[model samples]
Target: MTLTEKLTTEFRQRCEGIATEKRSLLNIRAFEPLPADLLATQLGATILTPKQIPNLNPCVVAVLLDSDQWSAGIINQNPLWIVNNPRHTPARRESNLMHEFGHMLLKHKIVRFDPDTGFPLRRQSDEDEATYLGGCLQIPRRGLLWAVQCQMTQTEIAVHFNASQEMVQFRSNVTGVNI
Candidate 1:
């Protein structure tokens, strides 16, 4: 199913509310940028590269370090250890961490990987929800509107928010706020 089919209007608004609540907790204004690293710290989460994971197989680490396909994941829940791919751009790293944080905020259960494929058995709705929430966390609808009011271009907004231009455009498209 498509993302639109998985996520409802109320769910989207709830995600926006979650973003606002997180910002409030951090004492960040609606128009201000919320850095994912700062948020992770506030959440008592430790961000780690694959290499930082002790006892990890060297071959697995090599595969992870060499690839850009993977983003990030919460490897541990008690201490909230998130392993992110270091090969990604800074903006991508932020987005990746935010997506993982989205899953955390939503209390999504960790999905087991398929033994045959070695890929996580993700639920489409869960992924959709996390993706929507991640975008909201990166660029809240109110923040987008504020940027638009300030006459910021998509590129400028991306730079201001420390996000990729594509993310800014995606936020605009989803929120129906022309940038």
Candidate 2:
């Protein structure tokens, strides 16, 4: 498998393991605010912020990039970045950060390439997986499933989990139920 594939597979495994624990996944109340430094450490990356590295090489959480910026990752040993698009709900950011971690874990295999002038970490399958598992990391499938079984609208689920509308929509699709 390619780096992205391998990373997604492994990440899925880790997520499964997390699913095994008996903790209440619905206990997820807020955005699960991840510290930039801690998130970098969790992903095993040395955090380099915009302040430390300047616009060219700052490892950014890009919620909004004009024509020039990408969200997250290391590029050519220079700027490793992530998008901080406010368009994403706070929960979206949480999942997105995890997706960004996928890139870091996967991309080091080949030489770090320069930013594509876009945060194209994973577009199709890779992007989908990242976002999928990112949602799982925030709210596990089992718990969310239980919530669905308990009769919650996608809007209610989104509200309860503090997830984005799109995330709740996707999670519902994965469950293959019409709620």
Candidate 3:
């Protein structure tokens, strides 16, 4: 099987596990936004803005590029403190927090920093897995299919899931469900 297929299968299983644990319907027509804050609390994590990080440099927060920035980072693995970018919209912030949660759930190790750039170095494979799983958590395949069956538009699905329009489009593309 192709790598994409393998990843999709695994992510689907993970989503199912989460749904079962949460006692949510697996075939939901309109996916309600997973409360990232609640999830963080359950996972012994706390979400905070970059500026809220104690003793964080103001220049560092100012220099973040909201468009392609590292949306969130799970600092302090023991206590699990997540730092999300404040510049993002609410929907985008939710996705960012979900992505961070993905990493935490997958037990990904703390990222190493590139000394030259003074930035955290990411593993492409890990990032891909987290992104895929995060999307699944936000909009599952069953949920997308249900939306299509219900004749929901991309925008409608985004609103229902509290996700960005671009996230909905991406889900449609990946799941091959026409909006």
Candidate 4:
């Protein structure tokens, strides 16, 4: 299998209620960008929007606060902040934070310096892994299975998961799942 598929499969196994209806109050965010504050809380991480953080770096999504707060998520210092506005869909923001969390979880740190751009460096695999993990974190394969088995249309799943319709459709194709 391809690396993305492998990583996705591994991540899905971590979920306990992939195929069943959840009884917990914690809702599964589909396409909604989780409120930065709430997401930070859920992950035991903190969000330091453009104003809150100092000594920031470029392309730096956010600071991963390890000592306290949610288990993981970003603290984007500046320009990259996309979670604040209601104009932008919540699903997108939630997905972005999760993606950044994947970066921390995978130990994707700046390893070197790019002389050409004078920027910090990271592995391509690390980048890919973060993106893949982010999506899988939000959309577990087993949950996808349950949704499909329930005959939820892609759009409905998108709303249910707070994910975009496109993501839901793509996931359906990727998992060979049917509704």
Could you say which candidate leads in TM-score?
Answer: 1
Query: Per-residue lDDT for 54-108 in model 4, tens only?
Result: 6655344243221222232333422333222222456766666666756655556
Candidate 2 C-alpha lDDT tens digits along 23-131: 2332332223223335445444544433443455433334234322344444333335443444444565555566665444434332233387643433455555555
Please count the clashing residue pairs in each candidate, in the order shown.
0, 16, 0, 23
| Candidate 3 lDDT by residue in tens digits, 1-179 | 43366476666577546644542533233345565666666678888776777787888766764335567888788878888887788898878987887787778888878999988999876787777667777787777888888899888989988889998987887777788
List ranges where model 2 is wrong by over 4 Å: 1-14, 18-71, 74-83, 86-88, 103-111, 114-125
lDDT (0 to 1) per candidate: 0.91, 0.50, 0.74, 0.53
Q: After superposing candidate 1, which stretches have Cα over 4 Å from the reference?
A: none
Scored by lDDT, model 3 comes in at: 0.74
Prediction 2 global C-alpha lDDT: 0.50
Model 3's C-alpha root-mean-square deviation from the true structure amounts to 3.4
**Could you tell which candidate, 1 or 2, scores higher by TM-score?**
1
Task: Please identify which of the two predictions, 3 or 4, would achieve the higher lDDT against the true structure.
Answer: 3
Ranking according to lDDT, highest score first: 1, 3, 4, 2
